[model samples]
Target: MDGGQAMIALGIGLTSAVDGAAIAALVRRALAHAGLEASVLAVPDWRADLPAVAAAARLLGLPVAPVSRAAMQTVEAAVATRAPESLARYGVGSVAEAAALVAAGRGARLLVARLAEAGATCAVAEGEGP
Candidate 1:
């Protein structure tokens, strides 16, 4: 437990609202802000489908969590941002938060609340693993 666990297994959630470059930067910031070692992040399966998300994952070596909608719904309450559109469509405030929580898995907790920047939104969650 040196340095209080250098690396944190963090997760992210996003949509097509962002481009590849921005996604990459968002991902980078998430890792850097966590101040972890050999940083790694996980995104929901749907986010992986986004060209920008895929590109970011490739650029940062981020893992794409094979999460299901049922799983994501389980963490809908944990989300911080409350958007009317997202609530009506996904039953969650932010897809990013839902996905981040799902990726983190059981006992998952928010490390960084949802952040909307550069036309994209993301949230960071920490759990047992990606």
Candidate 2:
């Protein structure tokens, strides 16, 4: 999943005021577990969530991409993991998976499904290019 034109997109979901270190660690573990390198990191475009997501991106030396709630909703049906709480609050089953799919765009597919640790979740998606 590295060494080519294959790009990995990461989507993150966080609880309020979660620490950047926790987010970074979880994302690192998820990437290593999947044996994939991320090209970009993404998060929902909610104002309160941006800081931690941005910090994680900086920690990983990757740019942060924001996916709107509407765009995330469109990919919810395709997400394999369903979190009832997230579905009730965000109108999506899994924020990490849906956001990754949306951020990666139309033909993107999940390379790693949602994985949670320390009040944060991370997922990876690969674009259908190269």
Candidate 3:
């Protein structure tokens, strides 16, 4: 996704019943795993948060989905000064490291890390960290 795009994903539970804070944490972790820095938008349902969530994803640097379009555009514009090359070394990683990556704005790296952790077959670039 471009820096101006939104990245949307499915939320596993209802905010009213599942706890928005907890789900946000999970979503953050998942985005980090995917080498993307993002947060769960505070909306009534996943549908409502789609835009915000997408914006968060773009801020962290990832491909935005339809639902995340609106929010992604906002964040992308906000973080325009940032660089995509920040996530040079990407692969599976722990939540702790992923959190650090997100904080550092290495969303793309976190996305790759999450995908690797999720069991997606990946080929690490030469001379890259594990």
Candidate 4:
């Protein structure tokens, strides 16, 4: 795709709604700095929420792989069992960690969604979520 036509997706992880909003603002600024103008999508937990992330990416006009709801639920259950405390303690670093977890195969993708829904600070780095 042409540089002008290429689209980007931004995901953010936040503890509160305010944090999500702030992250969105920061993302917009960063995009401006990079001369890119894409949208943002929130993902409560990036690591455990691959299904929702894929859905958001598709909504942003990007290609996506097929993910089953049952599989995503399994992922959620695994992560919830391991990290019962909260993601708020993890902070911004969780983003990279979550991606790494997804890259690995210890669990599924709903982990991120659960974190964010639980009030973890998570959103697409660019595009919006479904």
Best lDDT goes to which candidate?
A: 2
Residue-wise lDDT of candidate 4 within 6-45, one digit each (tens)? 2243334433333323443444454455565443342434
lDDT of 2 at 113: 92
lDDT by residue (1-130, candidate 1, tens digit) is: 3234323444555656778788777766765776643345556666667877667767777665656667777887787788898788767787777777776655677777777678676677766643
In model 1, which runs have C-alpha deviations exceeding 4 angstroms? 1-17, 37-41
Better of 2 and 3 by TM-score: 2
Kindly indicate the candidate among 1 and 4 with the higher TM-score.
1
Report the C-alpha lDDT of model 3 over 8-42, residue by residue, as the tens digit. Answer: 32222122233333444555565555564333222
Please give the RMSD of candidate 1 to the true structure: 3.2
Compare the candidates by TM-score and give the number of the best one.
2
- How are the candidates ranked when ordered by TM-score, highest leading? 2, 1, 4, 3
Note the Cα lDDT for every prediction shown.
0.66, 0.83, 0.30, 0.35
lDDT of 3: 0.30
Q: Candidate 1 — which pairs collide?
A: none
In candidate 4, stretches whose alpha carbon ends up further than 4 angstroms from where it belongs are 1-4, 17-21, 45-130
Candidate 1 weakest lDDT stretch, 10 residues: 1-10
**Candidate rank order under lDDT:** 2, 1, 4, 3
Residue 118 in model 4: lDDT: 31
